[model samples]
Every structure is written in C-alpha cells, then in structure tokens.
Target chain A: MREAYHEQLNQLADHLAGMCGMVADAMELATKALLDADLAIAEQVISDDAKVDEARSVCEEQAYALLALQAPVATDLRTVLAAIHAAESLERMGDLALHVAKAARRRHPQPVLPEPVKPYFAEMGRVALKLAHQAEQVIHTKDIDQARALEDADDEMDDLHRHLFTVIMDKDWPHGVASAVDVTLLGRFYERFADHAVSVAKRVVFVVTGRMPGSGDEEL
Target chain B: MREAYHEQLNQLADHLAGMCGMVADAMELATKALLDADLAIAEQVISDDAKVDEARSVCEEQAYALLALQAPVATDLRTVLAAIHAAESLERMGDLALHVAKAARRRHPQPVLPEPVKPYFAEMGRVALKLAHQAEQVIHTKDIDQARALEDADDEMDDLHRHLFTVIMDKDWPHGVASAVDVTLLGRFYERFADHAVSVAKRVVFVVTGRMPGSGDEEL
Candidate 1:
C-alpha cells in the first residue's frame, strides 16, 4: 500500500506534465489558426481546451485524494500541493491558447496579424510552445536549473511581446483601431501564456527547493 | 485535536474572506487612482498587494498543515481544497487591481480613461468591488444563493466591459492608439477582476453543492 501511494504521488507529476503538453499543442495549433485565418483549426483549439480543463480536474481530484487518504508527510505533501498549483497554471495556459484561437475565429477570413507583425506572432507561438515543453520536462525531472532556464526563455517572450506592442503603437501603424485592439489582446494572450509556463516551472522548483524564484517567495 | 482541526477549518474561511476584503479595498483605491491619476494612491495599491500575497501563503500553509496532520475527511477535505482555490483567486484579484494601478502610474497625471469612457471604468470599478464584497460574504456563509447572485453582478460587469470596448473601437475615437491599448488592457483587468470574484463565489457553491456551478462542470 505504501509503495502504491508513492507511485500515485509520482503519477500526479506525470499528470501535470501531460496537461502542459496538451496546452502546448493547443497553443501551437491556435497560433497557426491565428496567422492563417483557419477557422477549423481555431475551433479545434477551442474545443480541445476542455481536455486541458479535464486534465486539471484529474490532477486536482488525485491531489485531494492523496491528501485525504494517505496523509502524505512534509515533502510529499508539498509535492501534492505544488501539483495543484501546477495543474491550475496549466489549465490557465490552455485558456490563454483558447483566447488566441478565438482571436483567429473572430476575424474569420481576415488574418488577425496585419502582415508586418505576423512573424513576431509566429515567433511568439514557437517560444510559447518551447516554454511549455520545457516546463513539462521541469515537472518530470524536478530539475531546478531547467526550471530557472524557463524564466530566461520567458524574458525572451516578454521582449517579443514588447516588440509587438511597439508595432501596434507605432505612429505610422497602418492597421487602424480594430486591428490594433486584436493585436493588443493577442499580444497579451501570448505574453500571459509564457508567464504561466514559467510559473508552472517555478512550482516544480518550489516543490524541490521550497523557495520561489526571483527576489522573494512570490513568482511572476 | 479534531475539534481544533475543525476550528482551524473555520478560520481558513475567515482568512479567505479577510483576504477578499483586502483585495476589494485595493480595487477601490486602485479605481480612484486610475480615474484621478493619483500617484500616491496607485503606489499604495501596488505596495499593499504584498499583503494579499502573504494572506495566500497563510491560507495555503494552514491548508497544507490541515491536510497533512489532521487528515480531514470528504466535505471537510473539499472545503479545505476550495479554500485553497479561493485564496489563489483572491490573490489574483489583487494582482488585477495592481495592474489597474500600474496603468494609472504608467501615465502618471494623465488619466488612463478618456472623458467619454471614464464613466464606464468608474462603473466597472463599482461592480468589481461589489462582486468582491459579495464573494467575501459567500465565502463566510457558504451561501449558494449569494454565490449565485455574484454571477448576475458579473453579467453587469461584462456589459460594462463590452461598453468600454465599444467606446474604444468607435470610428471617431480621439484617444489615439496608445490610449486605446491602455483602455483595452485596463478594461480586461477590470473584467478579469470581477470574473475572479465570481469564480471565488463559485468555489463556495462547489464546496456546498459538489457542483462546479455551470452547465457541465466548468464555472466560467
């Protein structure tokens, strides 16, 4: 029974990593949908968000059961709690991806990105996917260094986000108001997605080291 | 020991409600800062956000202890878990309020909202505070009815959010792209704040009813 309990605890991390993988795929597809104006792919990303939400429920229910039934000790208890936080962050990442897809769907035939900013968004999508996968690995291995690396990658994404904002706020911006609003929200979506991925990796670091990265106990 | 555990569980709810009250005040002060472009008030809201983060740590550590040492059963287990969720939501609401305050500070002495949309933001702020206070009450009482009422109030917030967008997107908008971007993000910050409030209330309903308070299981 004790052996099975430890295995279940390991499985909780596995579930969180799996959910991160799902959101990564969702964001990748959603980014494609946004740049290409592919409504079908956009809809798929939106619908698949449910799977990510379900995955969170899986992690959470497992977490609650572990805490209630097994009475895990300090480190193990912290692991389960961290799983809860990681799962919620992954779930939110999925929502951010869905928001990206919705932006694509909202514009339908007209591409959301106004040509010049297209490559930036494409890069943002790639960075977001890479960060999510890195986060998954961090959760799996409990690698504090890899988790710390996620923050550096997130900084790169933030740079890209600021780049997009510059394009939007440029005095000579040609896209006008509606397109500007779309880009603003889409930039925020991608930026927030990366932030959550970093946050997920930080949770792993906290589980292993009991210290939140950055200046203090709280993370970005 | 069990009796003390039960008392701690009750205290958990009290702490969450207190945190909600803090965020509510933060948002109220933040709204003032935004409209009046009050740098001092904005800075205060930004700094006070740490207290809400500390409150979440308090709730989370208490929860982990209750789960590990006390081993609460089913409903008690769910309540503890829900408290964890509620605390996180309240912390996020505090962040959203900070976002608003920062927007104000970013354009110090210059109001974030234009004359026409100022009332919309003012109303959004009012609704956000109301929803948060209602959420605090629901958390304390675990009253499903009060929790349900939060959704209706959130609908009002949503309408105000949409109204802000309409103002931003108007063809004759004189605020320029920078101001439009600011309004878009600020509108989202306020809308998201209210959503978290309703989400907090929903957690209370979930603890009481074992349902997620939406069509299937997702709250939002």
Candidate 2:
C-alpha cells in the first residue's frame, strides 16, 4: 500500500509539472498575443483555461486521496502538501495568463501597449518563461539551488516592472487613460506571474529543506 | 491517541478561527480608514499585520505537528487539512487588508471619491464586513449554508467593482492617472478581501462536507 501510494504521489507530481508546462506556454502565447496583437492566440489562451482548471482538480483529488488512504507522515506528508500547493500556484499562473490574454483581446485592433514599452514587455515575458521552466526543474529534481536561482531571477522582472511604471509616468508620453490602464494591468500581470513562480520555488525549498525559504533573514 | 489528536485538531481550528477574526477586524479597520481617510487607523492596520502573520505561523506549526505526531487519518486528517487552508486564507486576508491600509496611507486625506461613487464604496465596505463576520460564523458553527451565503455575497462586491469601473470610465475624471490608479487598486483590494473570505467559507464547507465546494464549477 505504501509503494502504491508512493507511485500515485509521483504520478500526481508529474501531472503538476506537466500543468506548469502548459501554464508556461499559455503565458508565452499570451505575451506574444499582446506584442503581436494576435487575437487567435489570445482567444486560445482564454479558451484553454478550462484544461488547467481540470488538471488542478485532478491533482488536488489525488493528493487528498493519498492523505486519506495512506495517512502519510513527515516527509511524505510534506510532499503531498507541497504537491497541492504547487498545483494551486500553477493554476493561478494559468489564470494570470488568461487575464493577460483577455486584456489583449479587449484592445483587438489597436495595440494594447505602446511601442516604447515593448522591450520591457519582452524581457518580462522571457523572465516569466524562465521561471516557469525552472519551477518544473525544481519539481523534477527537487533541486533547492535551482529553485533559489528562480527566486533570484524574479528580481530582474521587478526591476523591469519599476522601469515600465516610470515610462508610463513620464509626462512626455501623450497616451490616454486606456494606455495607462493597459500598462498598469500588464505590469501587474507580469509581477503576479513572477510571484506565483516564487511561490512554487518556495514550495520546492520546503520539500527539500523541510523548511520554508525566505521566511526570515533571507531577502525575498 | 485518536482522542488526543482530535482534541488537538479542535484546538487548531479554534486558533484558526481566532486568526480569522483578527484578519476580519484588520480588513474592517482598513476599509474604514479608506472610507474615512484615517491615517492613524491605517497605520494601526499596518502595525497589526505582524500579529496576523504570527498567528498564522502558530496555526500552521500546530497543524503540522499534529499531523506529524498523531498521523491523523480520515475525518481527523480532513479537519487538520481544513485548518491549514483556513490559516492560509486568513493570512492572505491580512495581507489584503495591509495592502488597503498601505494604499490609504499613501493617499492621506483621500480625495472624496466622486460623490456618485460614495454609496458604492460604502456598500462594498458593508458587504465586506458582513462577509468577514460570516466567515467567523462559518468557522464557529461549521455551517455550510452560512458559508454558501458568504460565497454568494462575493458577487455583490463584484457588481460594485464593475459599477465603479463604469463610473470611472463614464466620467472624464480630470485627475487622470492618479485617480485611476487609486480607484483600480482600491477595487482590487475589495475584490481580493472578498475572495479570501470566500476561500475561508470554502474551507468551512470542506470541513463539513468532506469535499470542496465549487470545485468543478467554472462560473467564476
């Protein structure tokens, strides 16, 4: 029974990792939709959200069953709990991607963001993609160092986010309220995407170290 | 051993309920500060956030210890797990309240929200307060119907949020970027506060029903 539970738990972890990949792809596609103003990709991201939700439900059910049946203790308990946490984080990531896609779809014909902010948006996209990939690596290898690196990478995205805000705040730009709203919303999406990735990294740290990282003394 | 574990689980639930009360009060204080533009109250909210965090940590540690030492299964396991979820939701509520307080402090003497929107803000605040109180009741009574009502109340906040945006968009609010940012952030705080309340309610439902509420529902 223990071996079977272990196998079930491993399968759940793999499913979570796979969901993260899909969420990462959704973010990538949503970012591209924003940059290229591709309505098709935007709609695709929005429509595909149900799949992510389904994956989350399955992962959650599996974790609950393992806890109920196996009565897992200590490390095994932490692993199951972390799987649930990771699944929720990934689900939220998918929702953030959907939010970005919805915003992109709203301003279909006209570009959602100004050309000046393109570089920042691109960098944000790259950073988010990297974080997502790193999260999957953490799940697969349970590598605390890789997870730590993902945490560090979020700082760069934060810097870029601040820069984007500065650009928006500049009086030189003749943009209207729509532009400001788009920029602010876009910044929020990027920041939250990074935050969810950090959450995943933190869970990985917890899984390996049996303690939550960045809880004290460590800069988050 | 089972009886002791059950007793510890009950104690954990009580602690979680206490934390929820703290969070609800913090949220109420923060909203009042926003509505009244009271800097002192906002500061108090900020200062009290550490206490909420501490409460959450204690609850988590207790739940973890119970699970590790007692290895609770079946209903006992579910009860402990629900406590963990409730702690996280309460912590998030505290954070949301802090966000509101921080935003309020930043805009001391908050410019009178356009007269037309004052009632909307008030209504949002009232609903939030009620939801917070309802969350406490749900915890105390383990009443699924009361919890469901809290979930339904979330839609009211959502409606108010939409109305707020509509008003902002309809009027040519001269303040432009600052006003828009302030209003948007405020709306986000209210929405998030309600979301946390609903999450707490969901946990309550989970505790009683032994299954999550709105799990497969995609209406949200």
TM-score for each predicted model, relative to the true structure: 0.97, 0.92
Task: Give the best candidate by DockQ.
Answer: 1
Against the true structure, candidate 1 has what lDDT?
0.87
Residue-wise lDDT of candidate 2 within A1-220, one digit each (tens)?
9889879988988998998899899999999999999999999999998999999989978987887778788888889888877888888899889988988899997789889998899899999999899898888898878889986788888888878877877766667665776687778878888888888889878978888886421111
Highest TM-score against the true fold, candidate: 1
Candidate 1: segments with Cα more than 4 A from true spot: A215-220, B215-220
- Compared with the true structure, what per-residue lDDT tens digits does model 2 show for residues B22-138? 987898898788778899999999999999989988998898788778877766777777778778778877888888788779878764354566677778878888888888888
* Shift of residue A66 alpha carbon in model 2, Å: 2.1
| Separate DockQ for every predicted complex | 0.65, 0.41
- Candidate 1 lDDT, A1-220, residue by residue in tens: 7897899988888898899889999999999999899999999998998899888989999998888778787888888888898898899899999899988998898888899999999999999999999999998888888889988888889889888888899998877887899899889888889888888888788888887776332222
Model 1 docking tier (incorrect/acceptable/medium/high) = medium
Clashes of 1: 0
Candidate 1 TM-score for chain A: 0.96
Residue A181 local lDDT, model 2: 64
Residue pairs with clashing backbones, model 1: none
